[model samples]
Target: MDCIAMYIDGQWVESDSGNVTDIVNPANGRVIAQATRGTAADVDNAVAAAKRAFAPGSAWRTLTADDRAALMVKAADLIEARAEKLAVAETNSMGRVYRETRYDDVYAASGAFRYYASLVHELQGKASAENGDMMTVTVREPLGVCAVIAPWNYSMGTTAAGMAPALAAGNPVVVKPSSLAPVATAMMFEALAEAGFPAGSVNLVLGSGGEVGSALAAHPDVAKITFTGGTETGRDIIGRSATSVKRYSMELGGKSPFIMFDDADLDVAVDRLMFGIFLSQGQVCIAGSRLLVQQGVAERVLDMLKERVPKIRIGMPLDPDTEFGPMVSKRHMERVLDYIRLGVEEGARILIGGHRIAEGAFGEGYFVEPTVLVDCTQDMRVVQEEIFGPVLTVQTFADEEEAIRLANGTRYGLAGGVFTSDLGRALRVCSGVNTGIMWANAYLEDTAGMAVSPHRQSGMSVDGGLDGLLEYTVLKQINLKMTPAKSGWFAGME
Candidate 1:
């Protein structure tokens, strides 16, 4: 049993309290490995190291932008070399299908680092003339020490999402990965170290949110907190960081809606609709949990989904042919099942697979069959709340206006998509829907240069593009006076 230890000041060390947490393989609920459980004291050590590494005149802070870019590129290269190992670790630890973890998670993480590496050179300030006698110039400076909290669903991706930008901006980061899936994150720390990052420049502290996460949020030395998790937890971090008035960026929960109009190509709609909800077992924050279809085509679409969704392969994550894997844990699976029960009690009709699938083949793993609920109203809990599972609720609308109303009915506004061949209808629906991210004919297509914004209660943060990189920095204005002060204005008072 190899137990992973905390990485601080560029060294692997045991927890100060000697506490440990077990890592379970979601494929079969096996306790595969152990990880040291960090505490407040451990957080303090890592944060102190980050602060020191980010202090003025430190090697990390004094490096030129191009120098930092080169280091980031090197880190990216290291990640590419270890891609296969990282993919296996991620899949084994978190139950993500290898088909996805191998390509999307691993390479996407590497791409994030490389994207920021390229963007580091473009981190330029602005200058403007304030009349002829004075000039105002603005420059972006790195925030001192940043605490980056990663979510379990896409542990490596979210970790890279937060850490890459912070590093590119010359800010040292203290990362606290989710306890449920910290193995790949630890491996990433190893790769970064081998890539020659300065000691203490990038640190990792592994533990539960109540202990390590809270301490990181409230630490006085931390200048910013970047978090990706549930809405309630995001609220807690925001409140905790308020004590120090520390800047924060968060990508939280979403109950995104996928609208299919009568004009949509039925073939494309069916495929995208299924993948939009079922991909990653619907653990994604941007999962299209709500499916709003126009009344004219509702029955046809539901018929296609009902026939296709149940056929999705459900088995171990490592199986090359497995299209869907088990839920992350027994507790999460039960939570989703409970939501299904609630939906039934509220009078929604179950259209497809629903219930736990554990008998001869499941081997006590956390598995839930793909579920669909029809005859759902906008007010139903199943439609408005985030199930965070491979459960889709079908709701029909009479027209475009009704569809827009249904899509915007929820409290969340993270993401939504509109499917229609009519460009005018697509544009209209996309504009009327009140979500941070909107797609006319696609869903969850991401690149480093595009910004991911969450609206309303979904979250408050910047997660992509130049704005994402700029979130790790502070802006300062420099005003120079080229002319002497006017003494005549005060002559009367003198």
Candidate 2:
């Protein structure tokens, strides 16, 4: 196995504390690489580097928006050039399918950098004359050193999604990828340096969340923190950041609901459902894990899905026809299997694939078959919690209002869908559902348009589209001299 070094400041360095961990591929369970475990000391070095970059007269501080954008564009180009290598690295290191790395992950990751490149020019400064003789104008500046903790579900996408825009906005960042998938983040940062980001402007810190992540959040110099992970982890980060009163953004766990109404198109619902939870092995933050089908169409859809879900070809990540890949790790697989057990205990009928009792196709690596549970209820544990696996719970809702209520009832409001032929009902349901992203007549499709929002306990505001790029910015209102009028009150009093 290869030794994966940690990236800090502007160069690769061994962790100060000198702890190393072996990274296992969830696909067939092999130690693909090892990474240096980081501590507070390592986090400090990165933060200091970023702080220096953010300091006045530093290269990062003086760079023009276009200049930064150009550099990011270069980074994107380099990523594309190195696509095959990075894709394999990501798949082996993080257990994502190799094809996904080559296609969806790479596209999203590289496109984000390019997208934000052009967005640099869109940062508008506002002017207001009411403040004083000087007209006030707000300039959106970087939030300083951002401490980001990405989740295992999306090692590359989460990192690139948050990091690109944050960097494009001129914020020097310190990113901590999920220890589960640190190698992928390391690869991205390595490519970033190769792509020519200024030294200290972008840094990666690795280790456990307890050591590196929490420390970054609590770091005095770190200004803002953006994390994508479990909901409980998000809550803890929020609590930690509260002490320093630092700006924080979190894209926490989501138990997204997929609803297919009686009047909806079956083919559309099935297609959307396939992409919703099954895509990425159902390891998406917004995976439609809780599939809510209206009573009128529940049986038919379930039968269709039962036939469809199993037919999905699963194999090696690099295989061209591989439809499903392995989970991130064996530990995650165990968790998923346990949740499935819990689902059964809660009286939900397992429609397909449950036991991880060690059988054919199941080897050392953590691999569980994509499972579907029918006859589920909102009160059930499987329906409520985030399983974060290929298992989906199917529930039947009575009417539109009930569907809305059930969808909103969960603690998560990250994403949900309502499929209906009736456009009017779709619009109403979209408005009523407490989700950040809602779909009418589809699910998890059109994500390009549906900017990822961190709704309710799902965490904070969005991190996609105009809102996403804007999150990295802190506004400062400026007052310009409109007429150079004297202060009447102060002059009269004097």
Candidate 3:
């Protein structure tokens, strides 16, 4: 098996601890690669390199915005050229379908770099005259040594989303990808290095969250931290960053609602319903796990789900024909299974699947049936909490008010969807929900120009678009005295 190394100071190197963790293929339980497990010492070295790179007169810090953007464009091109390799690595490590990794993940990663490159000039700050005697010019400057902790599910894409903006803002970055699926992200570092970023400008460290992630969050030299993970972990990162008082952008967990009205096109609603929850086996942070259907059309929606869901192919991630794949790991599979079992114990009816596939060719892999539960209440744990798996809990709402109530009932406010042909009703629900991102007649669709700002405990700060690019920058005001003579206010004392 190939061993993935950490990229620090523009070179691929092993961990300081010299320890390695096996990277398993969730499809067949085979060890496909090994990632060097990073430690606090390794994180310190990476951060030190980043700090040096971001120093006032260093090569990285001295580059103009256009120069950095040009490098990002080259990186984007390289990423596109290496799409197949990256897609395969991602599928092997994380168990997402081949088509998704190839078409969705790879493009999303390259697109982020390209989009941020185009907006690098937007980091400009305004200048204004405060009285004729004094003028204040505000300029945006890079925050030193940004630390990005990317999660396992959408590893490469999410890492690029954070890193591209930070780099475009002229901040050197040290990224720690989740150890469970670090291979593709390590591969992406090759493109960054070849794009001619200054040494130490882009670095990668692979390990568990407890060590490498914690080190990055708490490192005094790291000026900012961008994290995408669970809510509990986000809280921990906040505490770790408190000592340094570092800036943080967190994209955390969600139990987003998919509201389907009685007048919604059943065909469209059913298709989007599946896409909203079952995409990536429902491992998405913005997965619409709560299905809130209007009472008039509840049975029809359930019937359509019953007819369509079983046909969803559960096969190896590498298979082109496979529509769905296994969980990211055995442990995660168990967690999902526990939630399914709990849903049953909570008196919810399993309308479709609720069992793990442990027989036949799937015996060695971590496979669970795509599950849908009906007769569920809003207060149940399975409905209220984020399962982070291929499970959807169904609830019926009597009217528009109830639909809005169910949508905002959860503590999370990340993303949600509203399916209604009624323009007025859609707008009302869109406004009523507490989520950061809401879609009408669409689900799981994203563009490079839009920002996703998590609300409540879902997370803090912004990700994507021009706003996200600015998150890596700090504002400084330069005041100039227009007059040749000093102010008369202090001259009276003299």
Candidate 4:
């Protein structure tokens, strides 16, 4: 099969060690392709190239903002043109449904580039002459050589979310996609090159997170690091980059809550609830894995779930009709299964599904039934921890206060949802929950140019809108003296 190579300095090349890792299709447990397993040496070379590209007066650094934006818009167009090819690559590599990869992931990827392109001219800084004797001007400059460590779930989407803003701010980047899903990201990089990005301005390195990811985090020349992954891994990256005092933007783990009140429209709530958790087979970082339903309507919600959960179609990722696919890998599937077992041991009841699909053709793949556990407590391990799979836990709350308490019980504060027809109650709960992003009467809606930041341990810095673009920049102030004469106080001393 095809072996995807690393894109460094605008060329595809093998790792110095010449090693490769097989890219498995999670749907059938078959190896579809191979990606070059990058090493520390390769990371160093990529960083060096990025440093050169970002240097003052270099081809990439000297380009005007309009020039950069023009190129980015072209890249976005190219990505749209190759949408199907990129989507198929992502689907085969990560087991997300082809429709999601094509319509959502690919569209979001190009949209990020286009959005940031539109904001390139907005990087202007302010000036003040309030003090007549002195004029101060503030300007933002690009940080040198940024490293983006993307997660496997939304590889192309997250990669572009980091890279597009960095590039728009005039920083060269070295991207390290999770080895589990790197093929599509590699293909997306090809579009960047074809759009006439300068050599070394955009680079891709593929390998395990432990090695290549760590290397990128600790690289001395890397001015900043943007990462989206597990909380523990994010902590490790922070520690690794600490010695250099580097800047970082982290979008870490989340166990977001989906709170449903007794007065909520049952049908609408159920549909959004399924979309919130079951989409992408529950691989989303912001997946609404915890369901906090009001006690009065708990049984009704559970009954609706019991009826609807089985109707979710699980099949091959490439099939357009498939609503769900296998987990990203066997190990991840087992981890999710173990969590289900633990929930049972901890006294939660499985209301719908809680086992692997080991029958017939599904036996060859890593498929787990979409599981929902009822009679769950706030302190249960499954409720407290992020399972990151197709499993969701249900807990009943007595009132609005209890619902808010259960929602904010977890250490994570990334995203959440509140379903209620009562505008006052919805507003109260939305304000009460400690999450960064909250949806009322809706779920999983992210508009372009909106900013989001982690509230608590979820992460740090901004991930969207004008603030995200500014994350790749450093501010400097230039002070101009109106008079070149020395002050009288110093003159007296002289």
What are the models' TM-scores? 0.97, 0.95, 0.98, 0.98
Report how far off residue 370 is in candidate 2 (Å). Answer: 1.3
Tens-digit per-residue lDDT, 224-311, candidate 3: 9999999999999989878888998999989999999999988998999999899999999998899999999999899999999999
Which 10 residues in a row give candidate 3 its minimum summed lDDT? Answer: 485-494
Clashes of 2: 9
Which structure among the candidates has the greatest lDDT?
A: 4
Better by lDDT, candidate 4 or 3: 4
Alpha carbon lDDT of each predicted model: 0.89, 0.83, 0.92, 0.93
Model 4 scores a TM of: 0.98
Q: Which has the better lDDT: candidate 2, or candidate 4?
A: 4
Candidate 2 residues lying further than 4 Å off, grouped into runs, are: 129-133, 357-361, 447-452, 480-494
Model 4: per-residue Cα lDDT over 1-494, one tens digit each: 67899999989998988789999999899999998899999999999999989888889988999999999999999999999999999999899999899999998999999999999999989999998879999999998999999999999999999999999999999999999999899999989989999989999998999899999998899999999999999999999888797998999989999999999998999999999999999999999999999989988888899899999988888999999999999999999999999999999999888999988888989999999998899889999999999889999889999899899999999999999999999999999999999999999997879999998889999989998899999999999999876666755554
Off by over 4 Å in 3: 489-494
Q: List the candidate numbers ranked by lDDT, top first.
A: 4, 3, 1, 2
Quote model 3's TM-score: 0.98
The C-alpha stretches of model 4 lying farther than 4 A from their native spots are 491-494
Residues 1-494 of candidate 1 have per-residue lDDT tens digits of 99899889989999878878999988889998899999999999998898889878888878899988898889989988998999999999899999999988988888889999999877789998857878889899898898989988998888998899999999999999999999999998889999889878999999999989999998989998989888899999888878788988887879999999899998888888888999999999998899998889988998898788878998889988999998998889999999999999998989998888887668678888899999898889998888999899998888998989988898899999999999999989889999998888887775549887789988886888998898888889999888867657666755
Tell me the number of clashing residue pairs for each predicted model.
Answer: 0, 9, 0, 0
